[model samples]
Target chain A: MSELSHRLSISIPFENDKQASMARKTMAVDPVLKSNELLIKFNQEENKLICQFMGTSDRVIRVAISNVIDNVKTIIECFDEFDGKDDVQFEEKQETI
Target chain B: MTQDLVPTAHYESPSEPKGYDFIPGDGPHSTIGETTKISDIVINAGGQDRDTPSEAKDTALGQLRARLTTIQDKINIFLTNKMKEEKSSKELKDLEKKMLDEGVDEGSSDNE
Candidate 1:
């Protein structure tokens, strides 16, 4: 419960609301570690993904922020590699079995 | 000849330069030793005048804003490419499916 010394907030804009929502959902699934030393919150506002971090030190804040950014990168990679149509086709194929 | 080869008893010691020898408007006259400051590598998120706790927080906020903007730019580019690829591939798959269905119908009609 020491006073959080550092705070960082970031808003990443997406092309549309859907992509922002996807990013928010993906990030929400992963819980932040060291909740006492750091806090991470993510929200989707229109076409922007808003991220906030509060930590006791610069290192903790930076580490939390970077970890989220890494996850965002992975989400972007998945979107690039696969589309909703492919997922639908996959599901349909599985249903036939 | 032997005296000329002999070391002098009053050998002059190398003297240190009084100050940096560089012309005011010209390039460096000699190489300056490499030096690094913490401020050079570590961002003083709170500027040099971080006297109070609030001031330090403000500096950290400023740094966060700057970093976020950079991250935003990167994510924007990646998302754009992702969307473009998704659209193109979906179109291609739709076209292939349509062609396959048409060929199946033609084969059935010819068998009649």
Candidate 2:
């Protein structure tokens, strides 16, 4: 019997380090789908979140990559939502509380 | 994030017919071949034609920005709800502790 392996790496650039860090934190909390068959890693460098995945088959690798991409999208959306006008609103709400 | 990125325009090489001059026997009396006339036909050369127009590219970029805004709004709603839930849970815990302490205080006063 022989083992097949596949790997994928993707770098998502953000506007700033804060955004990248937030993305890294969001993605790091989620556990991998198939722990035995796939592995996922995330690293933050300046304004980019570097993602890597390894799997036993092409399907697993692709699935892992897509899942991470979705997470990154959510994180970017969060940045766009909170980084400007929303921050002032959030602070005002906190003060009222 | 992936959806927000705008793709640049792409072009493909224009398909032009190749023209060649066909000389019939090589002397001044030789008759020109039929294919030789193809050389006289003007053919525009150089540079590939754009597959997508500039207007189309602008529209696509606009659509991508719109979609990104929508996604951001959804995320904002989700985060707001999460914060509200957390605040309410914390308030509930504080109220429970206050009630417990007051109960103990009342019991001690009654005993004294």
Candidate 3:
């Protein structure tokens, strides 16, 4: 294709570079289900995780971008739940899932 | 509020890709299981690509509404296709069964 039919960029600011990098790496590990119709690239800018989405259609990019946002929300939610909870019993036990 | 946990996004695009540095994948086909041939959510993109929001139709809300409409239209088309496929498949099966029954009846007459 001469030009991508749809494109979007999202920036999420984390607490630090480590957090941003973590988010980027985690999202990077997951594969894009539709590579032809959609491609996502994750980068880090200081404390911000920058995500770029290029796709062939509005719906394809929309679905993919929303999914990434949902996953990032979960990662941040985990930070809220246990990031600073030192000496928490949850960390001591092995994670099953 | 506990913190500013909002994510910002934009639609600005750069020059066309050079067909290089394209990350390789499992080819240019969908890797998702249970995929549908009905693709490309047909949508008339509004003033979402405008550099500045000049009117009500160019605002952030307007862009969101446009995007949502794309999804809505896609959902409608997908459901319609599903219904059409189901109806055609059912009719084909019924026709096959009818032909089989007619063949059996004709065979009985020849047996005499």
Candidate 4:
């Protein structure tokens, strides 16, 4: 059996709530069977990941997360993504602490 | 941080809906007509300048009092709204965690 050990971290920056919400839905159906909602964190916070799932290898995790990101792009194509609101903010972030 | 710094030029005039006067919390909680109108800015014709030292001190004290009251009101509004948002965000986060955990458990079983 495969180790089933992996960690997938994805940071998607979008200008508004519509894009963020779309990103969440897209991640729910990742083809790699590791789809999970991207943690939507407020930009002000020091800790980016508001959620996480731990497993045994980074390769599997990366493939799963990449699938989610691709799905998010698909969602963006179908709908109006970000409006660039005055108060709205976005930041793509990832780092190993 | 530099990111938090808003361009001063962006606060030009009332032309921009998000002006310097714009409240930071969610949307305007003030009722229509409840706030002082810009058009109401007018110099009182009967108002006289304070010439004496005592009169100047009194005027200064009154101005300080008014400013303090305005600051207090803003702080109260901010704290109230912040508490509400915190409570709601916490509840939503908890729900998201439960759903995600269930999904992860199902995935583990699938691997089994």
Candidate 5:
């Protein structure tokens, strides 16, 4: 009935500014599918990554937040597993079409 | 938007809890929108830094990992179980339609 007022904001911190920016860029790439029903924004503050969500109803907001957290975990895992190592080159070169 | 942005100086220290209003998903399927109808939950943590303070990287990592995992597990179970109600609703509609069609058939047979 009312406008989108249900809001949730999540802030995540990283070791440095670069990691925070990386998370923001990666997470912000995907736009909210139902903009009228829900809205999401990604921001980086120094070593922290921030996510804000507003939705028409609680249901929409919860689902959207869960999905975002899942993505965040994956990024955290990446940082945990391979934070500073150089990117590996495959033994054989593959041509890109 | 620039409207709600707060300066870094005003942000709280990492050691302190940002104290965001946590709304655990309501009902079995994380499917309740009732509570937030009138009031909003707002948590202002130094521009949203849930990360543990820098003194303990191990503690910070564990805290962050624990939080993400908890949210993931809880939501996954809720979203999975919430479909039961939806499925039952569809089945109920189908059963209603069948009963209506059968009633029409019974009436025709009575005429015959």
Candidate 6:
């Protein structure tokens, strides 16, 4: 069995208590999910992604989380490309049988 | 009576007063006036470190091109490696599925 590989992780903040609860719920199931108040950026020179979040207000935390997720997705997309070779693609025939 | 306009010649003359004599100061050293050196000094300083302008520019351009080529090579290597990893993972997954289908796991009588 091929192991799933994760290349990066990040976090952001949420200020809305209600939204923060919802976000926590989502993150509970997804290990890759995280949030921070400040938008994290991928620094090519540093060769790492960075994000910083501060403050306890729930509403702001939710916004931070959204921003963090968007930024992470953008960074991943920058490195990702369309290739027709993957575990799922290879196992398709076996699964049919 | 028609006024005759004489054509003026455009000539540049020295702006400073002509034939101005610069007399040395008649101080206490005037008796032993400063002597001017008539001989030229042959400077044996080191050679110029830099190339001619054209040569320098060519060298800079060549270096820039080399750096660009290196970056391109790195990008190509990264893309090739990514493709290889994808292919390798795919093949491994297929092999795993095949083993499961062939009852390779069931024949293990370790429990029996």
* Candidate number of the best TM-score: 5
- What is the per-residue lDDT of model 4 for residues B8-98, given as tens digits with 9 covering 90 to 100? 0111112223432312233222211112222233325544333211111122222222232232234334334544665787799999999
Model 5 interface DockQ: 0.08
DockQ of each: 0.01, 0.02, 0.15, 0.01, 0.08, 0.01
Instruction: Give Cα distance to truth, residue B89, candidate 2, Å.
Output: 56
Off by over 4 Å in 4: A1-5, A29-53, A80-97, B1-112
Ten consecutive residues with minimal summed lDDT in candidate 6 chain B? B4-13
* Candidate 1 chain A: worst-modelled 10 consecutive residues by lDDT: A83-92
lDDT of 2 by residue, B17-102 (tens): 13111111212121112221223334245444332111112332233333333332333343345446657877999999999999
Deviation from truth (RMSD, Å), model 4: 25.3
Q: Estimate each model's TM-score.
A: 0.43, 0.42, 0.47, 0.26, 0.51, 0.23
Q: Candidate 2 residues A15-93, lDDT tens each? A: 6688779878888999886688877888888876777766565456545554454455455544555565543433444
**What is the lDDT for A22 in model 3?**
84
Tell me how far the alpha carbon of residue A28 in candidate 6 is from the true structure, in angstroms, after superposition: 44
lDDT of 3 at A20: 84
Of candidates 6 and 4, the better by lDDT: 4
Chain A TM-score of prediction number 5: 0.87
In what order do the candidates fall by TM-score, top score first?
Answer: 5, 3, 1, 2, 4, 6
Per-residue lDDT value at A59 in model 2 = 50
Q: Write the per-residue lDDT of candidate 3 for residues A10-79, one digit (tens) a residue.
A: 6677766887898899999999886877889999999889889887755576577656754675576555
How displaced is residue A39 in candidate 6, in Å? Answer: 25
lDDT of model 2 at position A9: 53
Q: Which residue ranges in model 3 land beyond 4 Å of their true spot?
A: A89-97, B1-5, B12-112
Instruction: Using lDDT, rank the candidates from best to worst.
Output: 5, 3, 1, 2, 4, 6
User: What is the docking quality class of candidate 4?
Assistant: incorrect
The CA lDDT of each predicted structure is: 0.49, 0.49, 0.56, 0.34, 0.58, 0.30
